[model samples]
Target: MKISNRSTSTGRRRTSAAVALGAVLALTATACGDDGSGGGEGAEGSGKGKIVFWDNNGGVRTDIWKEIIADFEKANPDIDVQYVGIASTEYQSKVDTAIQGGGLPDVGGVGAAMLAGFAAQNALEPLDGRLAKSSLNGKLNKDMIESLKAAGGGDDKLYSIPTSANNGVLYYRTDLFKKAGLAEPTTWENFYKAAEKLTDKSKNAFGYTIRGGAGSIAQALDAMYGQSGITSFWDSSGEKTTVNDPKNVAALEKYAGLYKKVTPAADLNNDFTKMVAQWDSGTIGMLNHNLGSYQDHVKALGVDKFRGVPQPTGPGGRRVQVSNPVDGLGLFKSSKNKEAAWKFIEFALSHEVNSRFNESAGQVPANLEAAKDPWIEKAEPTKLAARALSDGSTSIVQLPYYLPDWNTISKADNEPNFQKVLLGKLSAKDFLDKMAEQLNEAQKEWKQQNG
Candidate 1:
């Protein structure tokens, strides 16, 4: 929670990866078959009963989840489904509170970013055995399956079922670009120049908007690495991060400096929604989001006005960006009805249901059959992205999704410091240094515990 343009491209895998996501879809939804208050004794509970399914991205993805719940309940009248929607920004904290105090959902979205953290706490049920017994055994994407395993600490044990790969997309105003005499924003140099030239503060027009508040770290890191062309998350020795390298700091400084200079002052507190709203309501030159926001933009500004493209290439004319996070469904260890929970997951992953969900979100589908839907070909951004990545001219920088602390460090610990850098209260170097320190320590601790 994530595009609408119409075009065709043959490489949907690259496009799916490219046009897939904006926010990492690590939703902490729950689907319990018994009374949620029943608590911790559900390790071997039955599978059919009352289910409380919670969604972290309430306003953004509420409709699709609700539709899915309705379909699931309709198909299995014996199972009762409860729906709860929470804001995306507050989801992580809510999950943390639940993890510590009590109450956890039985089944829901357990994506790559949160897999490590949740698995380390023993909150998720191992799904390898369940998959082996289900009709979905050979119908899933192997790469997505591997990504989940990598996030769960490079093990053979599977904790979550693969959903879809979520990637960052660059949405721009085609009309504005034509008027400004600017080229399509496919390269970093073009991005900077267009940001400067298209901006006219007197008219309240801007080149771009920034996600400075909640969920800011991922976007910033993508920008830093995408521009600096630093492809490794860690150094050559694997003991430290290359996040604080001179090239990266320079990249971040330039990207963040657009906060008020070319972007709006409201950006200081703007999340994805607000930033997208600004882009839609006003004359925005470009916006960095995913397929999740595509429908909104289309309704607000019309499909002809804007175009969704893959993230811009670095200075060296090579496409470089952070890899997309894969999202999925997981069964919680606290569920009283494991069998019932697995049923719901299987129902949702059925070809039609999964395809509808991704089509609505403007993302790539994880189900092999769903991915083959005709809707994917008509998706402009997804197709364009496929062409960008599948053409052998791209280099994706893989973020450390395997680390248990990856989500916490990227969101809670570093988001505030990242904002400080935008406000001129901290240097880009200091922010990166702090993030590097956290990542290095997390890797070290993981090695000590795992080894």
Candidate 2:
């Protein structure tokens, strides 16, 4: 759901505005009637009507959809899909309002983290039977499907299928590395040394850039926790809060260390755009990020500016990758075009469409068949990402939605403590203890709300 690598020059507020303008334009141009579904509650004059699909896959991936639309229309002359692209930031709140106001889309986008929240509210229709009957049953990446099922709950009833699979990795300026005689950092200790050596104080250069904006510092924290094998709150079962675990404390220590040596003084307010800009300008030597914005970098600085490496291993001997599966579609329970929506979903997941999307968008496809495509092997970032996904040792953090109290636990309680800890304003022990206490409170409240 999160697009990585935004340009540093475009401020967040401006970037958000631009995306919103695009969304408004797309919505106005595409869906202009009494809803795309063509009727009320249970009206049944269907087969050749329209289905609204709200998503943010508007860049290169949108073009792929245009091509797919041609093919799908040719195959099923009856169904017309009105595609509306919404910016990712506005997606959750906007969709929630629409759903509650009784104006939901027939089929809507669901990112890995958003799926479980929506499903928990019964906003999504189960697709277990539909997937089995369609040609797409065997075409998707098994791991991605399993992840979706996990996000949707253990019932094996899927609400979304990832359009792509992604894992965060280390991207560094190869030229900078060579100048400093530094190879990729295999361990946390080595990474620190490299950061110290590469930082040129005279040129205002730092070892690595980071995202420290309000809404994004947690992401940087996620990368640190991931690289250090720290659990945010609950353990793997999603049962109990444990953000204060000793391992988590260790992760915070590592983060504080990173802030001390590698990061720039201005990094406390930096975002992805700023970090990538610093990197491109040769001011920073390294960064930890997702590949979503790789294309933008290629456009701004050219293809030769960067290369990918695995995330550095922590003290625990684990190299975890902070990841979120690609956004995909899910049917709404109140759809008049349920069958037609399923048909389109089936079409979208087919090998032909999957290949087209991956090829054009530069995204690693979620289809098992598409992963074997020659293009994937040829792309450096894609190749490294694919290798990590297929690596059996890799572990996934639960999507934000899977943890019901994620909002309160992450934003309200832990985030402030995390900031204070990182700034050395709060001792790591105090921060962790407070985080644990807050998470336990949230878990108790959530149980009461949902039980």
The C-alpha lDDT values of all candidates are 0.78, 0.63
- Regions more than 4 Å wrong, model 1: 1-32, 43-46
**Counted clashes in each candidate structure:** 10, 3
lDDT of 1: 0.78
Q: How far in Å is the alpha carbon of 345 misplaced in model 2? A: 1.8
After superposition, the stretches of candidate 2 with alpha carbons farther than 4 Å from their true spots are 1-45, 56-78, 153-155, 201-204, 214-218, 226-238, 256-261, 264-282, 360-362, 389-400, 411-434, 441-451
lDDT of 2: 0.63
Residue-wise C-alpha lDDT for candidate 1, range 1-451, written one tens digit per residue: 1011111122212233322121122222332448777444364555567877667577888899889988898888888877778787776566555655566677767778777766765667899988989899899888889889889965657998887766789999999999989999889889989999999999999999989988788888889888988888888888788889999999999999999899999988888999888899998899888767878888898889999988998867877788777888888776778777888889888899889988887877889999889988888887677677679877888888887667767876777788899999999988888788777876776676567
TM-score of 2: 0.78
How many residue pairs clash in model 2? 3
How big is the positional error of residue 156 in model 2, measured in Å on the Cα after superposition? 3.9
Question: CA RMSD for every model?
Answer: 9.0, 7.9
Superposition error at 336 for model 1 (Å): 0.4
Q: List the residue pairs that clash in candidate 2.
A: 8-273, 48-78, 233-242
